[model samples]
Target chain A: MSRFSFNQITAKPWTLPEMVAGCVAAGVDQVALWREPVAEYGLDRAAALVRDAGLRVTTLCRSGFFQLPGWFDDNRRAIDEAAALRAPVLVLVSGGLPEGSRDLAGAREHVADAIGRLVPDAAAAGVTLAVEPLHPMYAADRCVISTWDQALAIAERHPAEHVGVTVDTYHLWWDDTVLEKIARAGDRIAIYQLADWITPLPAGVLTGRGLPGDGCIDMRAFHDAVDKAGYRGPIEVEVMNADLWERPGRDVLAATMTSFERSFRGR
Target chain B: MSRFSFNQITAKPWTLPEMVAGCVAAGVDQVALWREPVAEYGLDRAAALVRDAGLRVTTLCRSGFFQLPGWFDDNRRAIDEAAALRAPVLVLVSGGLPEGSRDLAGAREHVADAIGRLVPDAAAAGVTLAVEPLHPMYAADRCVISTWDQALAIAERHPAEHVGVTVDTYHLWWDDTVLEKIARAGDRIAIYQLADWITPLPAGVLTGRGLPGDGCIDMRAFHDAVDKAGYRGPIEVEVMNADLWERPGRDVLAATMTSFERSFRGR
Candidate 1:
């Protein structure tokens, strides 16, 4: 069965337990969880609780803020954290444009180099690093990887056995060549993320993504294409709506899962 | 000399004569006058006045709309108009997804095929066709040529001694690879358009464009980069602001030219 995991921002401020509970409530069987919640609650306890609640840890929410002076050490530490939780896929946000630096390609290269170095450690731990391409608007200030093409260019350089890309509709629905790119991506596409492209009120990334059905994107087609791509990975729901963020976390998670199923999986 | 051109929307509904006078008085040297303005005040007469005012027609507003049937005939008429008016470039707003079409790339191919055949005719008539990429938000309903790379691909396949691209900042300022793309584009760049990106507005495109100096894009860096790329073309000022659209024509023209100089090259 195909399943989706809300990355929490599809329902903001909701803890891992709450997201797990809500995903179960809304018929989602998997989740992509962030490290903060796991750390705060203790991984062993959280893992035990997740198993008891009957949810799969589809991916561990992240690693790769690769621009700091000590990013290598920090990134390695994150890989270690993913190992401790036994997460199947480690989701990476990649990080922002560094202070006073406008070198986007250079930052991307740093990420590739970091990932190359981390691959051995990741592969040994049986974890795959999922490179999530953010929206192009964040190309300068946030993640330098803004397209699956850009991400794959780097991933292709490394071993696909441990390194691959994530396809998020919110980040990619606008790409005129999205379907072709998705089909072309083939087996290297390790994750398929779901979120609708709501025009940001302020037109930036920290806010503005909507739930699956609230915006203009044809979510049904998007889901169908992902399904046809032959990769049965987690369809993680990740929205960064500021309005949804302030609402009761439970409402955010439950409502998102409901929309996700209706819009994403409904034929 | 870094001369600016008015993108007729700044003087909406005004007589071409009045708008031309306003732009010249504001020290602008050329115009990208719209088809409506030309139609309102007969094309021949409008051309005669713009020529008499010592202003060049940087580009005839638009000539591409492949999704709509009969577009070939309509676009041919536009090309004829461009030739008669001595417009250096004929802007092509490639039409969007046809009514029931889910395939953006297919729509793009249809557009390219339409333009490919038209390029010979455009070249024979001494007019260059310049593809103007609209922002990605308009991808589903407007032009599918949403990225420079995409536009460049079309330009490459359908090269006219007269076929090229119009680099509109409003449409592409967010892409991280723009600097490299523009640098590589060089002389193939026919128009370098300037507009500002605004935020904190509604959940749509209305009222989203700021005056050049009032927004966050590094306009000077862009101008300087294009210049360095050997594009000795006019920097066209095009604003799609709802507030400015509703203002008195003369004030809008003056405000636009002022904003252009402040945010771009006039020191």
Candidate 2:
């Protein structure tokens, strides 16, 4: 339980204060936060709220999208936000292909270059930029980095403290070689996230993830791999499902905890 | 135009006779046939219809759902049908994880073993079993084999003449190393398919693919890679869009051909 963290996106409608209170009430001492709600609640206020409640911010949800305009400034701002919140990691979902482009290889090269340019800011802010490889289904619009190898390659280009990979079960369970690769990744795994892969993916293919034990992913396998890599950091449950979001935040957190326990059952 | 083969599923509403006639009318002398419609039209008649139309059957659309109850016998029947139609290749979409199972590695191993079991029958039928690695999006309920490397690995274990990989642009395009891997695949390239990857994937995540040039896949890149691999074979434009299925057979074929030409324009 000490290693469990509830990513705020798992309960999308929860206000920052409400989420903080709910975490404290539920005996959860750690959380992973997204930028939007944190900004809406006022970054300093949100940071103070979590800190006063004695909750650790495991990560600042995201900051990459290098394909978008002003990404450089936007990401630097994100780095500042992570620093302000005292979060040690900022997740990076490398944006999809530049608009109207079929040059995937070029797009990928740009992401690596973009990350290199941001390493200095990350190092200064003391925020490790965790490059997350989204599922291949999102290679076009949501994210271009679509494999663990791709993320690790980019991360290997920089110091481990400034850059590392996010190992999310939902995005990577399909790859046969991912487990062994994750095991070998060692300290390069900045943050380990949990979400299960569900079938009949909804339109847009986003917000369809399952809770850890609700779908086909072998959660224990991922747990074992992460353990083998010597990662003792918080394990975040970062599921995004429309149905789960419709429920009350407390219920969502409870369900997430239940699923996490089930996933690690007998471990 | 000489290399063009319209996969039958592109015009789902077209009867086998109508499809064969439409292909002939469009000056397309090659086709890839699906088993359901062929069985519906009566396999022998469907075979004779295409053969009589002077159409070369490039591949029999599919036959590997190894996780299904009667896959062994069913696949053998499909191989026989492909032989009857004189299609040199039978594409295999290795079925998803076994019912309610999270053991992806075990499932994948089973697929390899199942294919090994089918290799003798395939060799005897003079059919190359084309193992298609579906997009990882389909890894849950469709095909567990979801990468060019996995397909190639399995194909390499068998005689190339008896087993090979299906290179579909939509499936492999997201892979950074796919182009080079395909380029070195040589004779393991059994069938080269083209379908662009369009976003906002509809429910079920199937039947939403785009025509060659309508989406982000670089078809010309695939063409260059296959050419580098020395594969001089039918290039099947195998797109399965719900909207496309609603169009007339002739219109779909014409649109596919136009997209194909546009994809290779200036090449």
Give the alpha carbon lDDT tens digit for every residue of A1-267 in model 2: 889999999999999999999999999999999999999999999989999999999999898999998999999999999999999999999999999998888999999999999999999989999999999989999899999999999999998999999999999999999999999998999999999988878988888999998899999999999999999999999999999999999999999999988888878
Candidate 1 lDDT, A74-138, residue by residue in tens: 76767777776666778777876676564556788888888888888888888888898877656
User: What RMSD, rounded to one decimal, does every model reach?
Assistant: 4.9, 0.8
Which structure among the candidates has the greatest DockQ? 2
User: Candidate 1 versus the native: TM-score?
Assistant: 0.77
Query: What lDDT, from 0 to 1, does candidate 2 have?
Result: 0.94
Measured against the native two-chain assembly using Cα atoms, what DockQ does each of the candidate structures obtain, in the order listed? 0.24, 0.92
Least well predicted 10-residue stretch by lDDT in candidate 2 chain B: B258-267
Error (Å) of candidate 1 at residue B234 is 2.3
Clashing residue pairs in candidate 1, if any? Answer: A202-B200
